[model samples]
Target: MKHDEFIRRVSERAHVSAEQADTLGRAVLQTLAERITGGEADDLAAQLPPELQEPLRRPRKAPADPFGLDEFLRRVGERAGVDGELALRGTRAVLHTLRDTLPHKEFEDMVSQLPTEYRELLRVDHDEFVQKVARRAHVSVDQAQTLTRAVLQALAERISGGAAQDLAAQLPPELREPLQRPRDAHAEPIGLEEMLSRVGEGAGVDEDLARRAFRAVLLTVRDAVPRKEFEHVLGQLPKEVAKLL
Candidate 1:
């Protein structure tokens, strides 16, 4: 969104007057734009008053997550071969579906509507593909699918090129309320390494060559004790391997 739209949105929801919101929005935009367009984040920090600048000087703290919304949408958009606008619409739908806890049909239709270029991205027929995005976003497969479909329907009205506003407007009435008066909460993202650690393999595929050493250590687990029993054994190796097969 442009500076004015951003200010308008924030001011509508906050105690800040329009002028104050505009100032705040400009500060935030300037901060973000500089970061995006090859300026040092430290330079922005330097521009800030001392209190804010102090925090910026320390070693850059790694974000708890690197696969953030901006990056995820960018990659997924590229793979899907849809413009960022449509991909964003799909993503918003995905996120909404997971949040409200919807059903599978919703997600399947949403995924199917995207351009065929996304085939490599999903690596599954439409049904499985929809389910996967839902699962990653932390909701039932059915719930994810349904919301995704709903998102597409909603986006039909507002989306153009991957920006969130038009899609944001189309959000379900229930969701609109929250968007209008956003809750005071942090939107923490899931990390890439954390997910690989959970899957236990495919270290090379999801990421680049530089992470091999980290993945190797992450893959190690000694002894085939019942994973359920690991903590009880104080991590001791069990004498028996329980094999149902």
Candidate 2:
């Protein structure tokens, strides 16, 4: 509760708009990102006073179950160290899309091909949902069902209703809060090489924009990559960096 509230508050602060909250989130996400990245956490906390600290603390919790619709989707994300709730929303969206377009047969087929490890996580209901969709799509029962489930989950993540908020609710407050206060966000801490690599790779950026973006990350709550980049590194570059002086 506290952690969630603190994030909400951080988004609300005069100095830290909602978009900037996301910047704070990125900067303080990893331990190495904090220590090695250099004062990333301190920079974020600078905007938030001690008074805001208490609210960002939530209780520790296990990620949601894998069988449940919302929880199951959440669990999938948990594997990636992401909160399940947020993940579910995406799943939900994909499901919504499947219901609207993809035939049941295609949905089932997709699931059958899922890695062996995936079978252990499903429930009868989810299976049934796939089965039904499979029949409608007029394809292999097993294969179509899987596809339907996959399609739904994929779509839900992009819908963006409350993915972050829902995920935050599932996490322990301390773990979540500390994520907000990474010790250093600008230095590109060593351990985060993979994370940074993933981001750059996923974004298809070839160069090392990590540090430049890291500096701007502390300024956005909206996740507007370009805008925030301009705001911190570009907008105030001369004044904030002071190389000229």
Candidate 3:
């Protein structure tokens, strides 16, 4: 998805404003880059959106050092200007999204390079994915699935046409439909509120709950697409929408 759309989605999921999502997303991604080997970081960077890739590419001030999950959360929290708890939540949100977007082996290889504790932080199963969203959104598993489908469809609309198609290609068959759904190319851009409304309508939930679900899916899409294409997607959005990214 586009950068603005991606941030807006994360903001909804993380229960933060767009600006806060931007801050948290960058912090989590940058800190993650520092924790892993340069080659591994580069490999992961190759798969991220343009606005997010730089965090993984910039030279680290110090060599990567071995660290546990607590230290990882502390560093990310410090950089994100949030407490450790909030940082940990944001990191999980980002990582879980990564798990969904990447191919299984690609995701596994990146996780393999990390310390053992890192594995638990990054790894997620299908049941866990559904359960986490259900808990956070206060919705049933069935509702969460509906929400997930709606959010992915909405995201496909915001991403550029070519990028959207590429994203569909990457997703599993179960997810490809939402990403490949047809949308009007010349339609006027809508703000987060409208997006949430559509998600609510599609998921058979209220706007408040839909917002939560929207964020959950959007955060993942942000890290899933190529950064350059994501930047282009951001540029095409309205100013109000762009501010969110």
All predictions: root-mean-square deviation over Cα? 21.9, 22.6, 13.2
Residue 64 lDDT in candidate 3? 63
Candidate 3 Cα outliers beyond 4 Å, as residue runs: 58-63, 123-128, 131-245
The TM-scores of all predictions, comma-separated, are: 0.19, 0.18, 0.49
Error of 3 at 58 (Å): 4.5
Which is superior by lDDT, 1 or 3?
3
Q: Estimate, for each residue in 54-161, the C-alpha lDDT of model 1 and write its tens digit.
A: 323423432222234456556545544555665554444322322123233333333333344422332223444344445444556655444444333222222222
Highest TM-score: which candidate?
Answer: 3
Question: Per-residue CA lDDT of candidate 2, range 1-245, in tens?
Answer: 24345445434431344454543433222211212112322332233435433322222232211243333443435443445544433333323322223233343343333333433332223334444444444446554433333322221222232332332223334213312312222222223344334434443443354323322222211111222222332332223322211
TM-score of 2: 0.18
User: What lDDT score goes with residue 211 in model 2?
Assistant: 29
Candidate 2 accuracy as lDDT: 0.33
Per the 3 Å backbone cut-off, how many clashing residue pairs does candidate 2 have?
52
The lDDT for every candidate, in the order shown, is: 0.34, 0.33, 0.68
